[model samples]
Target: MEKRLTHFSSGSGCGCKIHPAKLEEILKDVRSDVQSFPNLLVGNEASDDASVLKINDEWALVQTVDFFTPIVDDPYVFGQIAAANALSDVYAMGGKPLMANALLCWPVEELPAEQASKVLEGAKSVCDKASIPLAGGHSINIKEIAFGLSVTGTVHPQKILKNTGAVVGDVLFLTKPLGTGILSTALKRGKLNENGYEALLRVATELNTIGAELVAINGVHAVTDVTGFGLYGHLIEMCKASEVSAEVYFDKVPKIAEAVQYIQEFILPDNTFRNWNSYAQFIDCPLPETFAWLNDPQTNGGLLFAVAEHAVDTLLNTFQKHGTTQFLLEPIGRILPKDEKIIYVKR
Candidate 1:
C-alpha cells in the first residue's frame, strides 16, 4: 500500500467533515436503538460532550473519550493538544477530571514506537499538570498516527452542565478565538502568518483548566467546548437541547485577526463547505460569503459557555482573575424564546 501523503485536506479536525444534517441522520438510527437509563444525565439523545452517570445522589461521573490523527507536525505538541482536547469534553460538561486512559493508534512499520511513547509522555505531562493521572491506556498498530485519552471526571449532581441548559436571555461567551481550522490549514499550505500560526498552537496546547474551574465556580449555565463541529454546529445543539432560539452577532465573534483575509484569498480547508452544508438549517440570518469559510472546524479549541445574562460581567471578571484576560470573550448570541427553531446569525 502506498503511504498516505499528507495534504491540506480536511479542515482543522473531525468537526469540519461533520455536517449537521449527517449527524442528525446517524443519531436518528442510534437514538432509536438505545434505551434510556434513568441514571444517565446526558447521552446520545442530545449531542452533549460527555456522559454523566450517577455515582451517588450527590455526585456524578463524567466520562468522555476522543482520538484523532496528527493535526500538527511536532510529536510532543501533538500529544499535548490531543490530551487537552480529549479532557476538554469533561470540562465542557463542568467536571473535574480524575484519571485518564491513553488511546493510541500508530503505524509501527512507518513510525517508531519510541516516538509514540514520547507522544504518550507528552500527554502524561498535560494530565499531570491538571492533577489527573494517566492511569492506563490502549494502543494498536494502524495506518495513521492518532492519540487522545478517555478521561473520567466528577461533578456535583446538581452542577452537571449540558448543552441543553442554556436559558432564555442567557449570554453566550467563547473563551478562545475562532480560526484554528483556517490557521492550521494555512500552515499545511505554507500560507499562515506568524501570529495566526502562534495563535493556533497556543490555544490548542493550552488546557481548559481555567474554563472548567469557572464553570464550577457558579453562574455558568450550559457548556460545550468547540471541537470537530464548528461553533454553530455545537451552539445549535445547545439551543435545541435547551429548547431555545438564538441570535448570534457575527461581528462579535472572535476570529484570528488574519483568518478573514485568508478566507478572502480563498484559502480554505475542505471541511468548511461540509460544515456549512450540514448545519445551515437552524441559521436564518444573512452570512457573509466568507462566513462559511471562517466557521471551519477546530481541534483542541476553547470552552463555549452560556451564562445567565446578569452573570456575563461576572464570568469575564472571573476569567480575568484567572489570567485569561486576553481570552477574546464575546457575546456572540443570546438565548431566545423556546419553540422558535431558528439560529439567527447576523452582522
Candidate 2:
C-alpha cells in the first residue's frame, strides 16, 4: 500500500504558493486606486487574473508577472514549469503574448550561475514555442531560488475577456484536470508512482497557448486560470465580479485519474486549506467530503471558461480541430441568477 504523506520533500508548481491570507496581510497596507485609470479593463479592486491597459480604442495591452521558488528538484523542469505558469496569465485574459522578460532570484554564492542559465533557457524554449521573443529581463541575488516571466500580450479592446463578465445561463468549462498539487506533493515525498509523476510533469510543463487560441475563436464570456487560490477561490472571484452565482456538479469536475486514490492516501498540499479558508464565505458546498479536493491549489492548471450555450458546440468543435481534444470539456455548472451570490457547490 502506498503511504500518503502530508509534506513533500520538494515543492512543485503553485503548491509552493504563499497562503492568500498571509499574502493579503503583506499587501494590506499598500494602496492602489483603480478609479484613476479610465482605459484599464482589469486591475486591483476586481481581483482580476491579469492587468490590462488600453493602448488605443481597438487594442488593449495585457501585462502580468509571476515568480516563485524551485518547486521541483530538476533545474530544467523547474524552469519550464515556472515559464509556463507565468505565461498562463496572459492566456487567461484571452490574449496572445508578444514579449516576455525573465524574472530571476538566485543565490550568487551558493548555486552556480549556470543553473540559472538553464532556467532561462527553459523559459526561452517555451517562449519560442509560442512564437514570442525573450526580449530582456532583470535578475537579482536572493536567499533562495526563484524564476518566472513578466509577459506582455495584446488583445482587441472589444474582445478582452474579464473574470467579471459571466452572465446567467452560461455554461462553465474546465480545459484540464486538477491534481497537479497532489501529484507534486507525492513527488516531493518520493512516494509518487513513476507514470503519475511523469504525467503531471508533461501537463504542467505544457503551455496554455492552445487553450488561449480556443478562447479567441470561441467568444467566451468569462475566463480565468486556476492558480494559488485554487478552483473554488477563483470561482468565488468570478461569481462576485460578475454578480452571478454558480452551481458546480462535483462529479463533473475533472481530476487526474490517480488523484482520487492519492486523496484517500492523504497526499495533499499544505496550501489547500489556506485556499479554502480565504474564500469559504462565498462557497456554499453541501458536501463536506469534497472540501479538500475542490480547494487543492493547482500550479499550471487549466483554463475555466464560461461560454454561451449557443456557442458551446462551436467552441468545442474548434478546440478539437486545433488538437485540444485532450482538454476535458465537462459542464460542471451554470451561471445562476445574479441574486444568489457567488458560488453554490452541489452534490
Using all chains and alpha carbons, the TM-scores for the candidates as numbered come to 0.90, 0.90
Per-candidate Cα RMSD to the true structure, in Å, reads 2.9, 3.7
Error of 1 at 97 (Å): 0.6
**For model 2, how does the per-residue alpha-carbon lDDT over 98-201 read when each residue is reduced to its tens digit?**
99999887777767777778888888888888899989999988766678899999988887777888989999988777888888777776778877778788
Error in Å for residue 6 of model 2: 15
Model 1 compared with the native: what TM-score? 0.90
lDDT of 1 at 137: 92
- Backbone clashes in candidate 2 total 2
Model 1 pairs in collision: 15-228, 15-229, 20-278
* lDDT (Cα atoms) of all candidates against the true structure: 0.76, 0.78
